[model samples]
Target chain A: MQLLNNRSAQLRAPGKRVSRARVAVVRAAKTADGPRVAIVGVTGAVGQEFLTVLKERNFPYSDLKLLASARSAGQKQEFEGHTYTVQELTENSFKDVDIALFSAGGSISKKFGPVAVKDGAIVVDNSSAYRMTEGVPLVIPEVNPEAMSHIKVGKGGAIIANPNCSTIIALMAVTPLHRLATVKRMCVSTYQAASGAGAAAMEELRQQTRDVLDGKPAQPKIFPLQYAFNLFSHNSGMDVELGYNEEEMKLVKETRKIWSFPSVRITATCVRVPVMRAHAESINLEFENDISEAAALEALAAFPGVSIINDRQNNRFPTPLDATTKDNVFVGRVRRDISRDDNKGLDLFVCGDQIKKGAALNAVQIAELLLK
Target chain B: MQLLNNRSAQLRAPGKRVSRARVAVVRAAKTADGPRVAIVGVTGAVGQEFLTVLKERNFPYSDLKLLASARSAGQKQEFEGHTYTVQELTENSFKDVDIALFSAGGSISKKFGPVAVKDGAIVVDNSSAYRMTEGVPLVIPEVNPEAMSHIKVGKGGAIIANPNCSTIIALMAVTPLHRLATVKRMCVSTYQAASGAGAAAMEELRQQTRDVLDGKPAQPKIFPLQYAFNLFSHNSGMDVELGYNEEEMKLVKETRKIWSFPSVRITATCVRVPVMRAHAESINLEFENDISEAAALEALAAFPGVSIINDRQNNRFPTPLDATTKDNVFVGRVRRDISRDDNKGLDLFVCGDQIKKGAALNAVQIAELLLK
Candidate 1:
């Protein structure tokens, strides 16, 4: 361990590396009006993050139920001041729950998410199961909280879908500028982190880096390519006819759906980098109207969960390390696209913790929106 | 060393991990008309590659002179069983030299290149010093060899400039498709390597990684940001008015000059990655004529110094490790841009050894063209 760069700065962006938020312990002093909350798929990466986020945000709940697959059932999970045994998720799990957070795979979400919603529980699903469905609202709380504002817990059964992690991160920075001057076209190149692939992929990267440092060949168990000191196109299945992968399509289609615009031009090249949790994107946008650097910067600065690290004189910009374990998407390299003669094109480099803001935190924020 | 991923899989792209080519040892049995070569900045990264490229190409030389700064004047360098003393580069260094290959800094090249040309030696400069100059030809041998065909050894002296690494790597992959269908606009996002910043940055990355792994701070010496598992925008000075860096401007300007198509729109976001020596670029191009994936792949495959690694089924594509110390530019992700309504847009991922094809190998190829 002493001979290597083994430390990972996940969710702990540099310049703000110190973690100040500790998990808050909430006792079982609940009122009759408080909601009953259930965390589905509680053993997985994003699943575990739901608990941490709920604790850190001091989310109030009258009853807490932890559910997972059969393999993880009977496992003990310590959250706040309570020790709870993980129960295997079944049709009856959401019997009296007012809100359920789903992060299991698509099939699991497809099976259990609808069941949870039918049981009078508002399901905030972090899977692609409900997203892109005609009626399901794909929400990024800061970007489109109004899209799901009509649904309230204990009133009706509903499903609020979490946008893909990449989409969540990109839109957090782009939405503000889009409001200033409607985005006509968007060209995005993503430097995604291992966390997007799940906990196994993150472990695979860490172990591979260890193996490669020990002069061993990186075993490609989780991914098909070497993930140590190398980057490659996204591991998503490519749509042969369109030449776009499923991941790229998510960014393109999801953006249009979330913004409620059908004809917005979007293109993306998504590549997986060796970083642990934070994802960085190089986004170029062409707007319908002229937008200057000062205007664009101002819009990004005012956006919630967005930070400006653009120090051009010092050449300091956002890196994955700067967004590790961070809530805000770090925006920098904010500039005009010199290729376009019209003052309509702008470029930005964005970094955010895909596991946090892109997943659990965003889902929790959506759940918070239900209270309002 | 044992605790880190110190092993570099340079030639280990797919199945080819073993390096087969040994450095050729050449004796001075050349004919009378052969060129006398002087390698300026012989102690630097590209300077070292110039020697390797010359040896691998079996370039004919009657005599070889190794020239560096005053500090390295007396160091011994062996070539093809001939041990030579490094000489300090002065105004008189090119007195009898017929050809000079310069990998020195821009100032050194700007100062000595004109001197060498004045002393009857054609200088093939591998610096940004003369690339954008009005009359100087910025040539990528495979892309625009004819740009400097008029200059040759033993004739009147002239300066031939090597295009920027990002430009060279991109053009190698783009020029072929551009020939098939004229490119009207190009958008490039580069994942550049440490070598383009010269050898010290490479060493800094190595030392920094070791220091960081040893639980010590990554002291940013050559770069402002942490180089171990972190990336940033190109460290080149920014153009405040244009909001583009010197490197991004090089790609935008050099592409136009090399292609001699001034109206073509080009924009580049140059980023520095942690990769050791090779560069990877994600390029999206819009063309005047429709080009299919078959046609684009065919064009890339037919190009002399370009290779296609686009394996959709296996999810295999060109990676930086595949291009390390390689002569060919590895291209992949040959697909139509899904966002385009017409067949006007295409996307590609390209990787090339910046020190080799981007600099030394390219400069040496110019020398070969001069011989022809």
Candidate 2:
């Protein structure tokens, strides 16, 4: 697999299309036939990216079905050089479907996930509906593909949960190190982007920015507070007693489920920044065993789907724009934590496209694993 | 002092001038006499802010002199309803000056600081030049006024250093809690603003953002990387050997000096965000003694130059816009650290104006202490 860190500059170019052959690692061919695929929430930010990622990875699908709510039904979407009208999603929509990608929302996933699974589709859910379910395999394909190894295409119906965006992005960089030195505690502070809410949130940011620049008052519609040239705490519901927002708790709870390490302590502070697409995180990790900076960087460089940009001489580290629309999670500022007296702590800064690796691509990767 | 958290909404209002009488805590008036004051780097961001803050706080000045580099020497600046020409900063610029506020840069402070002191001018240097210098008191008036008790107007000449902006903002919230429970370890991640770099960087952000909105490429000038809708690690010089930038190290080293406790373990990841003028930080602390959320909030509320906006019910915490051009450091998301099972850990989000409290207001407050 090619180390895609050098392509980071090209990825930031506006309207530039990336070639999948150069970006995605070629998977071993299993059967000569591809599965029938269905994408739930075909009009959402993550749902739209699912098509792009599938087309980019050259995922073979015998029949592609675009599913959305009634409001978005009949919408025309172009995918793989073909235009398809989105169909209203229902229980009977998953007939003979081999793979189903769900990203509408947690409520929709909760109502329709089992319905689609009962119809014999291997449902790869992007929502939080089944993520913490005991039997559901919450997976980041690069980190833990074996969790869902029992399920395969054309087999009995199964639901594989994709971890939350913050969890996926953080684990993309931390899991490699966790394997080297057991992670004892993790502290993550996220600079999240506008796209995590939905496509409308991204549009709202663009429109609000224009209004603020023109000296017009920013109308807060999608968000409760002004978001133009400004940022706020994540709008997720908060556990008022615990003082932790749902977004922060998601990182804590989701990581424990994905890593299957319930004993590892984790805390996070998630805030929404005005950036368009990608999310950035400042992660501090404490390890059970001593790990040096050189050894950590060596392991990160060798990890698949991980790109490093630790250029201290130039002071160039990962930025959100560097990871916008990119496949790999960009990691930098890899250093031993000076706060710790021993080499048991490390600090890192990571950036990844929240809509891609955080949601769509991770779900698609799980779908790829099922094909095996 | 009246709690100003209620005025946070008005603070975010565009083009609204904050009335100082409603903002600043009333200090005791010494003598009828006022000091002869000079502002070094009067044309820069913090330099301009020093003029506003001085006027707002009603700092008594017998005569106000503006000093900058030769290029900005002839520029006229209006203050307190009078216009003054900026003079070229030199050894003779401080003649008969009782108080000199310096914000030009490190090199300018290094050279003119001693000159001003030799001329019997109390120099409040707002640079990193002498922050860690032994015997040179680094003060945040509310946090450590006693550090400069020996220096006074008309008594003798001395140079007092102001801590870094990130350090000042973080400590404004943390110091109060530290007083309650001794901090054994502190981890800070900053969402800094462009104003910290200087006025030019702020202008660059404005211009670049406009260009990007117009679909043109962002032309990076003040910063090497794209600054519009993007963030990067602090552009301060890096210590390649230690893998820490000079900005991050300043927080670690300056905190120990200000608190007069060198044993506290501190680590920081400083990143510049797209915000215009204010900085926000996510701070996690481990204390030697146990502290609760209610106890932490009580200490913070009682602390001067700090305001609490921890409304967990509304998920309305402090944003950078809430602290822009405000005197008080706005704090929110005050909660017990769920990462630790014990009550010894706490988490806080802090925001402060980089040019005001982080730079000018802090320097003026130190000058206020000197007035006594």
Best by TM-score: 2
Model 2, A1-372: lDDT tens digits are: 011222233445677665674434222111237787889998999999998898778887666788999999988886543357788998888986889999999999899989988888899999988988999999999998989989977778889999989999999999999999999999999999999999999989988988988999999999999998888999999999999998898899988888888988998999999899999999999999999999999999999999999999999999999999999999999999999899999999999999999999999999888877
**Candidate 1, after superposition: displacement of residue A128 in Å?**
1.1
- List, residue by residue over B81-157, the lDDT tens digit for candidate 2: 33466778877888868999999899999999999988899999999999999999999999899999988798878
Estimated TM-score per prediction? 0.91, 0.92
Which TM-score value belongs to model 2?
A: 0.92
Question: Stretches of candidate 1 above 4 Å error?
Answer: A1-32, B1-32
lDDT of 1 by residue, B1-372 (tens): 110111122212356333233222343223346788889999999999998998888888766788999999989886553456788999989887889999889999989999999999999999899998988999988888888877877888899998999999999999999999999989899999999999999889877766766678989998988877778899999887776899999999999999999999988888998778899999999999999999999988999999889887777889998998899999998888877799989989999998999899999999889889
Model 2 stretches astray by more than 4 angstroms? A1-32, B1-32
Tens digit per residue, CA lDDT, model 1, A1-372: 110111122223356333333221343223246678889989989999998888777787777788999999999886653467788999999887999999988999999888888889999999888899988999998888889878988788999899999999999999999999999989899888899999999889877876777789989998988888788899998876676888999999999999999899999999998778889899988999999999999999999899999888777789998998888899999998877888999989999998899999999999888987
